[model samples]
Target: MDQNSAKEGKGLSIIAYITIIGVLIAFFMNQEKKNSFTFFHIRQSLGLWLMYFIFGYVISGFDSWMLTYSFWIFFAVLFLYGLLGAISGKANSIPILGDFFQKLFKSLGN
Candidate 1:
């Protein structure tokens, strides 16, 4: 939680938001150091990617461009929010599902 820790983990934390693969890479990379900042972003990105895939499957059934665009935009904003937080070395969570992600992935960094 200290600035030094955050600074140390900043690169991997940003990488965590790149994609699900990035999440895996970041997770494994952090295993050695066990950076909490990196793990926090990993959990957030993992949850976001999982939700995106699940919702994308459901959204595919709909032919509405509005729904599709909305889905894309929604996830985009959330990703951006998390990415910026990581870049800034802050541990802020995504808006609504952030708390759930932290709780769901509570065992991640342990």
Candidate 2:
């Protein structure tokens, strides 16, 4: 995408990483323009949030602080990574599951 497109989508893109609600907000807001950059981040954030909830449920069963802390840190780093990319107007995916997310949500911005 062009720089202008990136610039236009930057706000909603960053918002997409804020929370699951942000993802929904960005998604509906971007519906008219169908901004690819915003949609890209939306997919990433959506997947991350879903993973967080799913894993959080399982992690809650564990009593070890180490396990809990690790889970928190892992998701935090991933969220931050995606957030920074959106802030910088880049669409670099989060590591590991990024490609999977793109493929999984391929129909999102279509």
Candidate 3:
């Protein structure tokens, strides 16, 4: 990729990992100027956020301390992993969820 593409990819990827709102912002940002690298990160970030809310709710049902702490730590590690990949302009998937997210959110467009 060219310098501009790499720079934009990194920017989009970083913004995508920020928060749910950042994900939406990055989505629109890429609408006009599509970058596969950035799109890859967007899907991964969205999946992480989804896992956060979904698993968080499910984990809340349990009163076990070990489960709670492990749940948070597990997802935290995944988030950090994806964030580092984005910062490096890598299209690396976020462990298991990476491929699923890409396939699931492919309609999100270029």
Candidate 4:
């Protein structure tokens, strides 16, 4: 990547790790700039955030006592996967729901 591309990618990358507000800002900023690397990270980060919310909802509904322990483990694994993907520049999906989020947000890239 060129200097401009690298700069743009860096901005996108840092923004992705922030909370939802940062993600939205990054999404719009990248949209205006039209950076490929930025878009890739945005998609991944958005998917991560979406997955977090979905898991929160489902976990809240469960009544099992063991589920509390299992939920933290599962969330930790997913968090690690997301953080690794963002840091390593790999487009690998987060275990189960990653692919679904990609498909769901496909239109956003267009």
Q: Highest lDDT, which number? A: 1
How high is each candidate's TM-score?
0.99, 0.97, 0.91, 0.72
Q: Residues 67-100, candidate 4, lDDT per residue (tens digit)?
A: 8778778877876776666566565676787777
Model 2 misplacement above 4 A? none
Error of 1 at 57 (Å): 0.4
Q: List the residue pairs that clash in candidate 2.
A: none
Please count the clashing residue pairs in each candidate, in the order shown: 0, 0, 0, 0
Candidate 4: misplaced stretches above 4 Å?
1-7, 63-65
**Candidate models: Cα lDDT each:** 0.97, 0.94, 0.87, 0.70
lDDT of 2 by residue, 33-53 (tens): 998889999999999999999
What is the alpha-carbon lDDT of model 1 when measured against the actual structure?
0.97
* Candidate 1, 1-110: lDDT as tens digits: 88988999999999999989999999999999999989999999999999999999999999999999999999999999999999999999899999999999999999
TM-score of model number 2 = 0.97
Error of 3 at 20 (Å): 1.0
User: What would the TM-score be for candidate 4 when compared with the true structure?
Assistant: 0.72
Which candidate, 1 or 3, would have the higher lDDT against the true structure?
1
